[model samples]
Target: MAGARGAAALERDDPRRYGVNALETLLEGLVDYAGLFPPAALPMDDAVRNYAAYRVGERRGMLARFVLPVARLDEFVRAASRIDRGGDIGPWPLSVLAGPIDASVVAAFNREHGARWVIDSIEAKATTVGEVNAVAAAYGGLIVYVEIPVDADPAELVHAIGAAHLRAKIRTGGVTPEAFPAPAAVLRFLAECVQRQVPFKATAGLHHPLRGEYPLTYAPDAERGTMYGFLNVFLAATLLHAGTEPASLVELLEERDPAAIVADAHGISWRGLHASAAQVAQARSRFAGSFGSCSFEEPVQDLAALRLLPPRL
Candidate 1:
């Protein structure tokens, strides 16, 4: 589970300039940049530079907040200072990992450097109502997401999260096959969240556009795992919200053929099921929040290959 604290939308690519489409609606502000995390665990300076470059790139529409841990805020400040050439660079938005840190830590960081950047949201882990309530009390007034364990039934914890008026989070995948939760587990989590009207963001092992077996790491011969595609996950949420049955959702979650899904100006369709541009936009802006990804380029490149996105953008 990962989270950051604070509220308000980040500065992202203006979709109007490109003319909004179903695919664009489905994906805008859909990726929270997590370059500092595993697999592509980059050094601070490199990750900072990469995020800086992506903020102004064409596909910035799909980008969201920069995910950083509170412990490394000082390191981030120092590294970010090096690339602090003004212009359209920063005043960057951030989603901080709230690990054993108080909201005061983020408050202090913002007090000193709020003008250049802001930590608007936070991610934290919780398994019980006490932990969920504790996180809410500690970080009240900011957007908070509690990551719950899907390995076991998360209904109780999901209820706690919804009752608290907070959001939900799920770990879709990690570096190993063991890290990926079963499709049934994912479906149940999504179902519970939607039933409770809890919005969610996903993290880990979702850099690709479609589900398939892929290397767990960047090493020469990393172990392979069946990864859940971001499109599969997000679209499943969209369709689930539209009242698609649980069984169909499981199939959608495990969909592999790029041909099985279609995206065009009207909206995106999978099998015979379709969601119009408005429905896609509503689902994304409301229920299906973004997923965290280590590399922004991977999803973009994959989408381009599927011809869902232009090669240039």
Candidate 2:
């Protein structure tokens, strides 16, 4: 009898063969937990419990971060006290939302928790260049992500984020039809980030594995809205970062057919062009970061249902 090796152990010697290796290459540690936000807005207690469970669950390989609001830091710590954790789970890495990137505050929290938590990133809303600069100045070392308004001119703001050596953030979609940015806008934001060499993370609304019209909420009568599939956005990003002409990117982002995506160790193809897993991984590491979602199960389950992820045991 032997313990199971994780996703990292599924690599291929050739690095060009498809299957588990390629899937791992594409999805290794992707989703970030934002269960406190709208639609599924789980309470601090419930969200913390879900995060702790997922960190040790079978789908843990797909988990990347826990998004906690700045205002709820106290609540999170208090709720986290009741969840029993083993040594194997490690410190819960967090992306604190709406907080000043003050190292001392984070230090105090870490000091109190005895290595149960570590905060290395902060997500702040910035609608202008000056605002972005203002937030970037507050933190000296932590990765500060400034969420830019997609409706405004993101070029200058994105440039500022890059110049300030900070990361960019976007609200990819939300609970309403209007919450989702248009394909052109998303493509614009991603292209600008690539042009400016700024890394970014997406929050809210993206839960499906492919682009399609899905219910906006857990409510039965919730109106369906077109949501950007994580695959469409990330794959388009890989191509954009690799210097592929982005004219087709608009269509790529708007693409819905799961059959349109063909992936292997060599690379993944949407339509006719290809982007290697290493190239995509580089884009993920250096440019596009993890996306925030309320349900960890939805995206993983969707990917599995689509045959993108290996079937459950």
Highest-scoring model, TM-score: 1
lDDT by residue (1-313, candidate 1, tens digit) is 1112222443222333234456766777788999999999999999999988787777876777889888999999999889855455446778898943578898888889988888877899998888998887787667788898998999889998888888899999999889999999999999999898999989999999899999988889899999999999999998887777777777898898888888776667999888776667667767888899999999998898887773233
- Indicate the TM-score of model 1: 0.91
**Segments in model 1 whose C-alpha atoms lie over 4 Å from true places:** 1-19, 310-313
Candidate 2, residue 203: the lDDT equals: 81
lDDT of 2 at 201: 81
Report lDDT (Cα) of residue 239, candidate 1.
87
> Could you tell me which residue pairs clash in candidate 2?
18-265
Error of 1 at 10 (Å): 13
TM-score for each prediction?
Answer: 0.91, 0.90
lDDT of 1 at 67: 92
Instruction: Please give, for residues 232-262, the per-residue lDDT of candidate 2 as tens digits.
Output: 8888888998889879788988888888988
Rate residue 102 of model 2 by lDDT.
53
